[model samples]
Target: MESKSKNAPAKLHLRSGDTVKVISGNAKGETGVVKKILVDKLRATVEGVNMITKHVKPNAQNPQGSIEKLEGSIHISNLQVVDPKTGEPTRTGRKLNDKGKLQRFAKKSGNFI
Candidate 1:
């Protein structure tokens, strides 16, 4: 179910455009940029990670059936944002920056991410 509240606490920390690491499953330790976030499903698709093969049936674009490989959605809990300063995976937290705006910070290096 979707949270109707705009101020609802974040249940997942990963976001699109973030460089994230796969912490578990088949893609463990692999890192990639987050391509998209499926908010309702609490999953994120990371570029070049968790790849899955799909059989595309004949369509307007594809005259003949073709096989394709693409990124697959991964549970948010399996992802961790890479620390900007240290280039390592770390837990993230929301905090006020120098500008007094809430931003994500790496717990390992204490750097704004």
Candidate 2:
């Protein structure tokens, strides 16, 4: 007998180009734009936050091995959307306006995020 599996698509809450702040972590209070989202891992890569130094080995790509600073994946829960108008961390929610267009707004700023 064949069984039908029920699964839903992974939703990356923070999309690329969205501004966000590190809610709780070593990088707390730091804010940056969302660069990439890891759907499988439920993490997002925020620019200028969670900076980590990575060591590089001698390879064709890099003749000299050196330490490089790059962003590390942060759990989605550790991130909060930042409102452009108020410059505060806010929760994102969608609403259908009078024009029937879906828009994302910030709960704190009461403005489009």
Candidate 3:
């Protein structure tokens, strides 16, 4: 069964460059900057979190095989945006700014994020 907007992408609360905290899972309590948001998958890649190792074959740059550490994507449900003012994880809300444009704000501090 298809919904009304089958082609529409899922809405994600995260955006690239936003500081976020991992609230659950192996990396729980870890904080990092959002590197990318997988809207279709509802997952986000946070820097320095969810470390994964990849075996890289020998290449021109390196004669020996190497192991690489990379940040793995985590589901959005396990992450929360950190409030800029308080430097703490806080829930977000949309509100109209003074210019009448929609903007995201930190609900905990009542300040624009």
Candidate 1: residue pairs that collide: none
Per-residue lDDT of model 1, residues 1-113, tens digit only: 75644456455688789999999999999999999998766789999999999999998888998999999999998999999899999999999989999998999989988
- Model 2 residue runs over 4 Å out of place are 1-6
lDDT of 3: 0.90
Q: Give the TM-score of each candidate.
A: 0.88, 0.84, 0.90
Residues 33-113 of candidate 2 have per-residue lDDT tens digits of 999987766788998889899999989988998999999999989998888998888888888877999888888777865
Q: Is candidate 2 or candidate 3 better by TM-score?
A: 3
Per-candidate Cα lDDT values, in order, are: 0.90, 0.84, 0.90
Residue pairs whose backbone atoms clash in candidate 2: none
Q: Report clash pairs, candidate 3.
A: none
The CA root-mean-square deviation of candidate 2, after full C-alpha superposition on the true structure, stands at 3.8
Q: Which residue ranges in model 3 land beyond 4 Å of their true spot?
A: 3-6
Q: Residue 79: error of model 1 in Å?
A: 0.4
Give the RMSD in angstroms, all C-alphas superposed, for model 3: 1.8
Better of 1 and 2 by lDDT: 1
